[model samples]
Target: MLPFSGNASPLPRNAGVALILALAAIVTASGLLLWLQARALHRGTSAYAALETEHLRVAAAETARAALYVLAADPDLSVDHPGEDWAQPLERDWPGGIHAWARVEDAAAYVDLNNLACSNQPGRPFSAILRNAFTACGHFEADAPVDALADYVDADTTGDYEAAFYRHADAPLLPPDRELWAPAELLHVHGFSPALFAPPAPAPDARHHRDELFGGDFRQATVLLPDAPDAPVPVNLNTATREALLAVAGIEHAATVRSAMSLRALHPFQSTTLLAAASPDLASTLEGAIDVKSAYYRVRATAEHDGRRRSILAYARRDPDGTVHLLQWLEGVS
Candidate 1:
């Protein structure tokens, strides 16, 4: 069987096959190593991106705090109006095309939901005032939800729904039976809905009748929660919109609110006593609901860098001693 004479042997062919297998193994191992290296690099880049975004967010938040401190130190903290330096928007440009900005607003301009209840019980005078405001703004059926909210916060079971109503739901829930720490907590209540709480969108027609009724889409109305549970929530005469003033004073006091607004434009009230003197009728009606100075403010800050964006929302308090303190901080999605 020794073909092509005795010179050819089978061992030579076996050796050649072994060489090809070794080469194939080497190629496969190289490809695997390359893939692993690429995956590691991708993970490192992602981590770095996240770190940079966090830095931007922190920088923006600090900028907001600094501005608030300056505002607190100002000589005249009696009034917070649209034309004030603190109310104006702030922006700054940084290295690597990064930019940061912040905006401050007086929290007293909005209605405090906690003020709706008196000593953990509902049906207080403030509740009726809010209902009247909602009705005047064309949301006539606001009683059920508002009452439900009051029941959810009060320390008793006197709301429109009982504990069984929530317990028997698809997902059982329980009320906190305490003051709400944030306005967004309303979403957890039985009757509260996002549509009712969210800011209204612009109407289809620019000149619509509902515009007048709803105070130009109700941009002036908002809900706020103070850091102090027992502190009185008073609407700031200098910062509150006419709609808010009317809401706190009731629809019947529309003429008085208009007059007060006009008077404040010419000369902002330096004290609550001055506001009372300016509108004796409104002063009598909204004795406990109105004020001339603001103790709380909301700050919104945003930062952008290398096509990435970060945002922060904060609730702050300016003490009577002219010190600013942060009550709550919220970090938003990019």
Candidate 2:
């Protein structure tokens, strides 16, 4: 006989087990739902953050453009409105709680590309002093990778500097006709020092850095001159600060500078070839130092293009009027 005290209700036991299983399933499902909801919320927050960053960047960029327009409209903004410093905040309280501020800058205060002597002038005095410094700075350092760079770029090859560059490098050099669009290309040139070719580093305390001393402005720095448009303010040849002259890489010749000056003194050099013939001493001291035309201007602008933050970098001259132009602009954004 079955246990005398046992209740014969099999359905009761089955129901109890079923209820326990159902409770466990409900708990697991709730946990999964909570996890999915949390994940979705995280994703939404990240997307919102990115969108906000983009909005901030656009606002900052617009501020820069507006300031440039203002300056372009006023020929004497720099002198007359000295307090319109772009570094200051551009604050505003707007509807919908959207506010933006920006900073603006001029690039001429730093090293000017206008003064360097690496252009293709025919015969010009090498700046003994400057060359010595440059050489000491590793240009001619023994065993440097680019020791041959100057000789190659300066050589009067049937091909331009590009052809000479690849020819001088060891076999497997870039194809012979390849062009160098950036100064960093010098690293590939023969006789260049490893130091020169090595990437630049941020200062010990600085949090930023760049690969090239210059990004890609060398191409824009050259000038053909008599052909170059008369700038809003002419690049004073006689008084063209060394920075302005260095911008083209052609003005290194004392003769080129003097001749350019004399032409301005006599009138701007009307023809590129005549620039050299103007002053024998300057012409002889320099090679490829003078040109009758110029197409670019040296410009620098710093702004808060990221909206809430400001970023700054040197800009090569894009045009003479100091309007919106292009140059190497670096952002902290990676």
RMSD of each: 3.9, 10.1
Q: For residues 1-334, what per-residue lDDT tens digits would candidate 2 score against the true structure?
A: 4323456644566677798899999999999999999999999999987666665455445555555454445443222212333324445433324454444433322122223224432343333322332433323343333223333433234333446456564664643222234455555555433554343344455664321222212222222111111211123232333333443233334345444545555554344446445544444533443333222322222233323443332233334454545454444431
Instruction: State model 2's lDDT.
Output: 0.39
lDDT of 1 by residue, 43-114 (tens): 999999878887888778776776686667757766666667778888877666778888888888866776
* Range of the 10 consecutive residues with the lowest summed lDDT in candidate 1: 116-125
lDDT score at residue 225, model 1, on the 0-100 scale: 61
**Segments in model 2 whose C-alpha atoms lie over 4 Å from true places:** 1-17, 74-323, 327-334
User: In candidate 1, residue 159 scores what lDDT?
Assistant: 61
Worst 10 residues of 2 by lDDT: 224-233
Q: How many residue pairs clash in each candidate?
A: 0, 43
Best by lDDT: 1
* Candidate 1 ranges beyond 4 A from true positions: 1-13, 117-124, 157-165, 199-201, 215-219, 272-279
